[model samples]
Target: MNKFNGNKFKMDYSQFKTEVSKRRRSAATRELTKIAYSTPHSVISLAEGMPNEETFPFTEISIKLNDGSDFVLEGNELAAALQYIPSQGFPPLLQVIREFQRKAHAPPLWDSREVLIVAGGQDGLSKALEAIIGPGDPILVQNPVYPGVNVVITPHNAELIPIEQDDYGVIPICLRKRLQEREASSLKMPKIMYINATGANPTGTVMPLERRKQIYRIACEYNFLILDDDPYHFMYFTDEAPRSFLSLDTEGRVIRLDSFSKVLSSGLRIGVITAASPLVASIELHMQSSHLHAPTLSQVILYKLLKIWGYDKMMEHFRRIRSFYKERRDLIVKVAEEHLLGIAEFSVPSAGFFLWIKVPGIEDTWKMVMQRGVTHGILVAPGAAFMADTSKPCNAIRASFAKASYKEMNVAIERLALLIKDELAKNRSILNGNT
Candidate 1:
């Protein structure tokens, strides 16, 4: 044996596990594991924010290859699934996204504006925040907002100023007042105003067109960047969907994010960010450094689909998806009316995947739902997860109808109603000094 040769030694790899940041030690991470292990047979998983994969048109997908054999790829879009191509994504895909936005929003023609593809809407949001928001910079968001943005904001050391919101997404009056307050106090003005605009998360509220115009005006007045994170824009069942903030944005202050996760397949991880050329250029640079680029295969596949199906065909597909979700929403609302209306309150969502339910006398609804209701074979996302401050107690939970079948949904609703009733009874008992 040579001098340095043969002794068996165990490498000390323990240090790798200890290097996690404090922010990573979140309750959400723990809750995710718990959710994974618990199997509810009547599991109406109103928790998954993703689209129902069953609705994707498997038959319409086809891939043309240079080889003699035309591959169907499991009777699905396989060529697009297998290939690895570009970082900025395929040009054809970008064209499709741009065209989609144009038809949906009817924005004025801008020669310099373009789209930058990323992994998903969340990825785009993270990159956009990184490009614009420096550490400790104030960023404005609605009080009860999507938790995805909060996950990124916390780690980056950015201050999230929670603006109160009413039924119309992100009340314009609150935003204006907050900006004025910040100005008067010489506080750091918000660099970005993150709004869901179309269908807000948890709240299920849609902003009106007039409100969009008002928000755009305030954004211009305050000189703050407006990040319109709209994934559910196309999911509106009503004929009167709100006008996009991007269309109303005359100033170069809006960065609009769109995702195929809700409409198409979430696994593809495809989303696009549209903005002024300069801002997009910066975001592109950031993307190149971070993810290199969004997968080329997905882009190519999407381009093919768009080319064949065209915009009208795609809109019809979305309308079908909307009808499916709308029916589910109606069913859930009916159950809530029968079982939960007097006991609990909720705003009817016109579009998107969630219903925000508020239950009285229950502080820490998240803990109660996970520990109690989850054990009872029912699951729901607590409202506290959406808030920036988890220390504060929340009385609400978010219920989604996107994943569950109708029969399963009924069982879950019945179970959830019982849980709420029990909790309410316990609260009453305590107040009456019977506990």
Candidate 2:
């Protein structure tokens, strides 16, 4: 466990920031809005173009829950929802998030760090990548990473340094080896490493605490950043949730992305970026030019819900969510084992709702999934979709039990088993020149 004493080991954010991020400044109207917001209510003199709340069509918004409870937004709440808010986020929601962060991760440098609300987790991750990566810049990434990360990196023309993973998640030895091998070459070394640490997409594996510590130590030694995009942190099936990279971050090198899509509502489009203040500022500046801010209405609704739930009730909601998903995970695992025991192999997912399956004797599962699985009345995500190099063959397939019913999952796995058998038979026929 490496420890840092105060600000002595603070990371130089400038070295990790890009040239474009350095040029970004707060928008003129936004800056003025900030000043106007800071002043007393009596000193408000109109300096920017903002609409009167009275002109809006709706005077109030009401949300009814499944338990026959209603949350009404009226008066000032409705007004705030309709109007533009700060780029960082609504203050009430920020306070709730700050409290949650304190109780949960308890980041060592809480005072020096800040949080920014983005449209969603993807938006936050994209903005963070945009803030740091330039064309041809080298970046370290888990080999079979979430394709969405690649989608953001590809547009920037980043040189992705792929590090392979075992069943346990990314291997620490592989990371050190890659860095060591790259040091002797002409390729530019990576300054950023992106990972979906908990309930990782596609693989559905949770990184162990010891491995996380090793990786964090490696980051401290090599002087780089870790993009810890963890949307399924609270959905763990284990007795205790795995610690996040942010928990181990004492040097302010981890930019953690958290989302409500998996738990609350995906349509709400709300996520947070917790990082050092300078990095948060850069992402906020980027947001000013892009989406400007997350939907004010979404922020207010979430704030109202959180305020009603409070810290204790919110924690209860997380526990319920975990149990709900855990049941589904168990059901799907049982069905998969019953149907795919000898034909395919998969590890029971520890956190997220996905199961990664690999079929023996199959070079690539893409054709079976995209081309034939549909005909069989079942569809699972092809492994190639999550790979860094899509051109290469991938024998794996990602199955999700999140939304499907037990009977539906059973049927889907049965169809998959048959499909694999058909592909295997066809391959054998070709080998014997009988086709």
Candidate 3:
């Protein structure tokens, strides 16, 4: 060992710096270094990564306190909102979310599961993907899955084997068949199975209890983990609440993503991941390095809401929210039945924002959306967007009733019906010409 300045420790600037992996370095590194640590008082700078005070607009925000008095957010607290805080989150808020999770799932005490606050479900999922998946690793997904999820898996260069889904969500036989087939392939079998489960994206089919049990069994049999992405869990129209995979996971093989985007407000961007503590710790380390943490301000805001509302009051709030969505679901279904039902069959949509409708004659939605949806002033999400392979055939379209006004929903279905008619007419002409 060599020492400088005749001491045990030597100040070698080069030695002080440890090497970062090539993967850890990104295009952002250069951009982050371009900013000044302390701006001059005379020269006002606007290159910071925060919104302007005028844009923030709110000096004081208030929420009802426990006894119904207003709890105001301003002064130093407001400043804290603008400043950075803990990477885990605001300390008190993390505890609040922990309480919420315990009440929501009631997972066994011995299980050693925990929650990590995230920007949203997508953020939590991305971290999970990074933790569990890598190049050439195979991940199982429900076919006709959420396209965003498909996109997430793409950069990893991981193999995606899709399990088929019926009205009740993923079919057991299809899952088994795919697993068995993959077993024979030279490629590595899928080590993780992902599903939207509650109010599945696009399809809006809630995975029934028995189906979930069957899915858990399959995961056990295959010795794989389950990534249950259930954003619409609280939005269920059914009388009883759906059980989460976290509740069923005895051996800690499931990682669940829950979101407040739908239940609370989309802009809030607060989400939670409940999984075995070990997995949560791994994902947390990723969060610490990447995002550092979800916005501390948002977590503090959510904490106030939860504290004032409490568990029972929060449940009441959720009930009203669920009821509102149920009404929209009913109206949208009625509109579809009146105009587009015969032309395009769709599931009743027991939960979630969208109705996944299939047009019998159409082979793909890209053309259908172009010719009918746009021309008729009814924009739709092509089912192909949700497919694992976008090039695969997609006859379905996803229409969300959440943001659409009642009149828009009604008129949109009428336009869809007309579009279907045109496609049918074209098909008939082709058949006649062939004859």
RMSD for each model, in Å, please? 15.2, 3.3, 9.0
Instruction: Give lDDT tens digits, candidate 2, residues 358-414.
Output: 987899989989999989999999898988888899999999999988899999999
lDDT of 3 by residue, 111-226 (tens): 36667789988898887777777777788899878876767778878788888888889899899988888777755766678899888998998888888999999988877889
With a 3 Å backbone cut-off (N, CA, C), the pairs that clash in candidate 1 are 87-293
| lDDT of predicted model 1 | 0.74
Q: Is candidate 2 or candidate 3 better by lDDT?
A: 2
Question: What C-alpha root-mean-square deviation, in Å, does candidate 2 show against the real structure?
Answer: 3.3
What candidate 1 gets wrong by more than 4 Å, as runs, is 1-86, 433-435
- In model 3, the runs with Cα more than 4 Å from the true position are 1-59, 63-70
- Backbone collisions counted per model: 1, 0, 0
Candidate lDDT values, in order: 0.74, 0.87, 0.76
> What shift in Å separates residue 172 of candidate 3 from its native position after superposition?
1.6
User: How close is every model to the real structure, measured as TM-score?
Assistant: 0.81, 0.96, 0.84
By lDDT, the better pick of 1 and 2 is 2
